[model samples]
Target: MAEGRLQRELNRRNPFETPEQEAVLNLLRTGDLILNRFGRLFGEHNITDSQYNVLKILRDEGQPMPSLGIAGRMVQVVPAITGLIDRLEAKELVVRRRCVQDRRVVYVEITPLGTKLLAELDQPVLALHKQMVGKLSQPEVKQLSRLLEKAREVFSQ
Candidate 1:
């Protein structure tokens, strides 16, 4: 049957690869699937994942932050932050204020409208998290979180 043939092809692998390589490939594949699901959820709210992240960071800081500061917190380049802020400003979700003391510095702040939007998203966001990993017991969740943090420690060097 076609299904059987397809399964056989999928299971086929290079004989030269070691177990570590296969494990890493599997991890990448799983991460992609998880991120894709979150992307679709964020898209339904008329904002990309990156835009949501920017709004969240502003909310967390509870004050306008310099453009460079936001970029530094994120893994994005300084130039890309300008365009991102531009789009958010155009949406009226955020506003930009130039530093009076230093004209070269710009601060970005989330608007009241942005806060309301994020509030509305709160329930759905929690629901999505529950859908993703709610089945795990509390201990399992803690263990998984620890493992993920440890994995990131590898790159801290």
Candidate 2:
């Protein structure tokens, strides 16, 4: 039957035409899977991955930063940062203040509540990082990270 022939052909020929294409597809698929897992983990604590990223960035800076500065640090657009800040502010995780000297500029600062939540998330976040790439040896992880960094360099142009 035609079905049998199709099955035979499929079995004879590999699904991917080239190793490079297969590797790229595999990398994208794996990244999606890992991100999904991380999303669920973060959602359990009432935050999305992006929200956590914003909080962590603010924490690391150790001081309030201009809204544009935060947007620059993030991959998101400038306008979207306003909505994101609104949501975080609504949740009492962060507060926004207008710069006294420059009324046009707004600064975002993480609240104490945000700091407490981040501290709570620390253990689980570290565990998730370990679990995601734990199978790889340290050298392998370092090499993989280096390769990925190099791959990103192409986009900077």
Candidate 3:
């Protein structure tokens, strides 16, 4: 039998123990490759991807949103969300507002600066996504999405 792409890349002396193991490794490798590309791009803009995501969620809401509410939409943990907000606040891209009646509830709103930053990033981000997926045909892209979604379903079980 011919060696597979991953076996050649890993320079493995033996085949993967199972097809599931091979698939998992491939997914992880691909995720790391894609993440590195985006990390560099976001770093150039002086913002991490996590920070950018916070701004995007705020901007999309078009109003102040409770901090926890924003965090719910993100992959970040609740505690980490507070840190993300703090950094953004330091950058003057967002402001934290305490609810008038509920001191414990903090709301995060994107500042004009935040909105501007996102606007500036819109084209470059889109271009990067296109460049990343450029090799895949439309149908291939759809298939890949479906496969990823199906993989995610496994976690729900």
Number of the top-ranking candidate, with lDDT as the measure: 3
Instruction: State model 1's lDDT.
Output: 0.84
Alpha-carbon error at 128 in model 3, in Å?
A: 1.3
**TM-score of candidate 1 on Cα atoms, chains taken together:** 0.84
Better by TM-score, candidate 3 or 1: 3
List residue ranges in candidate 3 displaced over 4 A.
none
Residue 19 in model 1: lDDT:
54
Q: Who is ahead in lDDT, 1 or 3?
A: 3
What TM-score, computed on C-alpha atoms, does each candidate reach?
0.84, 0.87, 0.94
Q: Write the per-residue lDDT of candidate 1 for residues 1-157, one digit (tens) a residue.
A: 1323323445764341555665466567667777788899888878887898899899999999999999988989999999999989999999999999999999899999999989988898888877777779989989988977887898999
Q: Worst ten-residue run, lDDT, model 1?
A: 1-10
User: CA shift at 5, candidate 1, in angstroms?
Assistant: 17
Report lDDT per candidate.
Answer: 0.84, 0.88, 0.91
lDDT of 3 at 143: 96
Global fold similarity of model 2 (TM-score): 0.87
- The candidate 3 region of ten consecutive residues with least summed lDDT is 1-10
